[model samples]
Target: MASGPSDTRVLVVTTGGDAAGEESDVASSLSAHLPGQTVVRSSSTAAEYLRELGPTVDCVVAVGADADVVWTISETDPSIPLVVYGEEVLYTHVDAVIPSTASIDDLVARVQTEVSESRETNHLEEVNAKLTALSRYAKQITGCETVHDVCDRTVEATHDALDFDFCVLAFVEGDQIVPCCSTLPMDAERPIDLGEGVAGRTLETGEPQVVADMQSDPDATFKEREFRSVVSVPVGDRGVLQVVADEADAYDEQDVEFLEILAGYTNEALARLERETALRDERDRFHAFFEALPVPVAYVEAERSGEASVREINAAYERTFPQAADALGEDAADAFPTTGERRLVSDRLRDADPADQQIERSVREAGVEPFTVVLVPLERIGLSASGYLVYVPGTVPSDETRTGYSS
Candidate 1:
């Protein structure tokens, strides 16, 4: 589990014309018990002292101060814990109220407890905010279509969402890890051999590695020697993601966990893109086969209106029916001129298994001879689209078939 801030700062203020001597004694007592904490004694009014150093003070201890001063500090920065060491008062805004008669040990313990609780609460809120931003970045990563796009978005999220000082996204290419994108400038982009550096080891082992002091760690290697700390995580089997800092021991376990979560998102996005690219290549090969066929073929797909339309027509389809060159995007039923032939084609389009329905039509009505029209459902070829391939054999002109298509 991640811990809170290492050091706590407490401000002791005197109000209501009280002497500074009592405040000094209270600060000294608190300092003796608190150890490793700062105790500031201020003789000025609570409001003035708060305005000067409000941001740094984690907790406040008002000595001989009244309820009004307590309210001022609470209203000025309600997040800062406040402890009142004077006459017990019923102030709902104050965190703790200890009477002057109470032992100095009691006051010291109260201040320490309040400061620890405040720091813990602040740390939780910061972590929650970073996780929320990371979730939004995950959505953006899903929208990326290529590996480069995903890597670029990952680097952007590392800087904007994780707030890392430096970051690099590298992919494993053959026996080397190549830099895809980086937050810092790279004078010479070079590849690192697998199992050579921290990132290489991460990619080789398929695990996350965090080095608090890269200079002292034998497994760590730096392209820029200024980076002293590093946290690297594997991006599935494709690559590695690394975040670096200048100061030693800059990152903790929580930082490693956060980077791992981001790397998981990147891995999922890359896998999705790979699947889509393969599907696109398959579709392209099928289209090439459809075009090279010597028979007339028309690709028809269902539109938003639930009507089938001519999405694409092959060269032989245009040569057989020259009028179809301008028929792309037209309704499938419109391809036939006769009412009976149009009805037959439209009925096949609505059938769940159109490939089994074979119909012969006479194109003489459209100034051509009779031929057999074969409806091959696109789903037969592993396509997800609700469409069919209209195949007409022996329809192409042998001497000269104009090679033209509309898509």
Candidate 2:
């Protein structure tokens, strides 16, 4: 079995030979080079010893012993590596079959290096899994439409993923942990004092802090002995976002680094969410204005041929022209033929002199109020129209002849 980084236990099974034989010497050398684990020599014969020492042995540092005996022992426990002293080695399962004459330091060094590399590979696989989870969280945070949504998700995701007993995300409002999101169930929200806690120190200095065992740690200020692990990672650029988690000695340097990376991406997403919210508010305000306008407004689309297409007409348009829907996107002149003493509105549209154009209308239908129609260029009304904002009868025509600079 592969042991931990600080330990490598090997069973030395040599022939019943001299005390100063290569196997006995290799056991002493292995003990000196490898830090932990005992290098023991089997007192029984190799055949008898192989049956006794099974999975407990990580490797077998074999010295000059019978090939039949060695092969008999090695085949029984293939997991245990065999580093031969001065024997022709023919085994596929051994990690490295070394000559027994090789220096003990070299063997120990190889074992230590392999053990460490395996641990690092495992840690990296764990990091990759964590990164995949954090990326999903990032997408959810940015998808939200409210600022509170961002804050709530940040605290919840951190708490659940890290297995922390307590978690509090605070915004840095000039040196205070303004409690924005937390997992304190059934408690009223309160701001944590910046100068009073470990989290506060990180915010004030813009550096991360972790107390592995809070009770024994000198830097830890909180007297709550139940909580052992404390980690504080700053979220924003230059300490603007703050995330602090408290567990039972679970948070390490690697965990802190992972949280910091999560925070950086979260900050950008929240910032964008804030801007979208503000823009939506502005659009809502315009909607209110569009509904309450005093004058009739028609959003008109102008064709290149100078024909007016009424895209939208307000409530006032229904009172002005009872047949407004039929008139929409239809030739304006065809809908209302020009009466005497009035120039054709279509003729003025063809000339493209929308601002100065005015036509008098007399409705033959009884009880109808005579009105004068004025056309202001639809483009000027924010609805680029060969179209015009036709006003009520009392409205005066704004000057169209005035010269102005075009942007």
In terms of lDDT, the best-performing candidate is 1
- Clashing residue pairs in candidate 2, if any? 85-100, 229-249
Structural similarity to truth (TM-score) of each candidate: 0.83, 0.57
Please give the lDDT score for candidate 1. 0.73
Pick out the ten consecutive residues of candidate 1 with the lowest summed lDDT. Answer: 398-407
Who wins the TM-score comparison?
Answer: 1
lDDT of 1 by residue, 1-407 (tens): 11444555677776534456776777788777775565564444666767777767888888877666667777877778888898765644788888888999899888878878877887898899999999999999988978888988999999899899689888888888899998755752468888788877887678888888888888776634777888889989888889888888888888998999999999999999888888789989989998988877778777445666678889887776657677688776776444433444455554555432223343323654544455555543332244545555434332232121211
Clash pairs detected, candidate 1 = none
Which regions of candidate 1 fall more than 4 Å away from where they truly are? 1-6, 16-19, 43-49, 89-92, 185-189, 303-305, 336-354, 364-372, 379-384, 392-407
lDDT of each: 0.73, 0.58
Clashes of each: 0, 2
